[model samples]
Target: MMAYYARRKLPTSCLCRVSELRRQFTSASPLFFQGTSSVLSNRVPSSAPEGTRLTGCNVFKNKDEPLALADEEYPDWLWEILDPEAQQKKLDADPERKAKREWRARMRRKIKTDNFLKTMS
Candidate 1:
């Protein structure tokens, strides 16, 4: 566990969060680096499109899904797993977005501390 984070020297808070994330995904755990490769290999589209499909294009095959997850185009499943503060910071780096992310981070801290106080009481 020490070796895992030693490569990057991430802080203890980040390490605790990563451990929590590992516990969260324990049911369907896959190697952190190899992400979704096995899933992609086993995917089979239900039916072929009517017109000719282009080859060597990087576009997403699922027309039903949006092209990007950022810019508020994320799916519900993604939103569930995402850290809202991190997502906001990554998707929009403007001063307004920074303010919003900071507020959200503070709110989360407050909620967690409040819950801890409740448990203690």
Candidate 2:
């Protein structure tokens, strides 16, 4: 069965022809197979001058800098959304959420106890 499949000629498509042409062109070109010495030469200098840094984004603020805009410029809800402590405080203040949190904790403890008992048995 392996020999029968191996002897069979596979049908070639336009994609196969284009890929074969691309392979031939690339293999013949000296630029395509050039050494890493060219790449090393193209690299930026190790010691870049101070104050000019490459940032991934346009906002070039340091990591230590606060992300919040002025309170007047940003909406109150935006600040509330950004602050995890405020969100947690809000959740704690809500009676329904507090009950749900307690219920989840109880369920998790019950599940852990049940699994422990099963393993012991």
Candidate 3:
């Protein structure tokens, strides 16, 4: 880990907070370098985005291109480590999306009928 940071020349302070990290947690975890005095606090990699490890050309700069989660992007690690029970609650509490889906389907049918009538007239 130190080797990677040294290669990148990042300091130990970069692992602090968002306002602090404003550009951290990119390619690797900052915790890995926190222990060693060899920590490097260099800015985020130039190859990556301003606040991320992925750069503009290499990454999606707009909604058309979304960043894929390293994991399920469901239960964050902090949630699992701090409150794992919350994960279970989410699965158990999927409330009924069926109602909303049905409403949307009905609205679509109405729209199609209205459009057809206007075309016929």
Candidate 4:
């Protein structure tokens, strides 16, 4: 491990010295303000206007409701994709899905029969 690190010419001792210097600088630095005399301490409370709703944090929007679009405007295929019943029908119509379902049912029945036979024996 030492030979591999030596071959790569990595300064392991310099890394420890750099970390110590960073720790000392961070501990001594007065960059962060802690007392109430700081500029951030003079923050004003947010208030929403009459009839408008506050949907999110610090967000205010008009009281106007969204207009509903006509269902006829959207494509038939889009509605078929969105509808749960239509999606189920589409999956049920697939030959590969039908085969897998039938195989699963047979395996479940076989498992139950084997368990019953083992219990009887």
- lDDT against the true structure, per candidate, is 0.46, 0.46, 0.41, 0.47
lDDT of 2 by residue, 55-91 (tens): 3222333554223233244443432332344467778
Across 1-121, the per-residue lDDT of candidate 3 in tens digits comes to 5577557655433433322333333334544233222122321232223334322223223534233343323333322322224344544466465456668899999999999999999
Q: Rank order by lDDT, top first?
A: 4, 2, 1, 3
After superposition of all CA atoms, the RMSD between model 3 and the true structure is 17.9
- Superposed on all Cα atoms, model 4 deviates from the true structure by an RMSD in Å of 26.6
Q: What's the lDDT of the predicted structure labeled candidate 4?
A: 0.47
**RMSD of candidates 1 onward, in order:** 17.4, 24.8, 17.9, 26.6
Least lDDT summed over 10 consecutive residues: which range in candidate 3?
A: 35-44
Candidate 4 lDDT, 1-121, residue by residue in tens: 5576568665465345345544543343242223223213322111222444323222125534333334444344532332344456677889899789889999999999999999999
Error of 4 at 28 (Å): 68
Off by over 4 Å in 3: 1-52, 57-96
Q: Is candidate 3 or candidate 4 better by lDDT?
A: 4
Tell me how candidate 1 scores on lDDT: 0.46
TM-score of each: 0.27, 0.33, 0.27, 0.29
How many pairs collide in each candidate, listed in order?
0, 0, 7, 0
lDDT for 5 in candidate 3 is 53
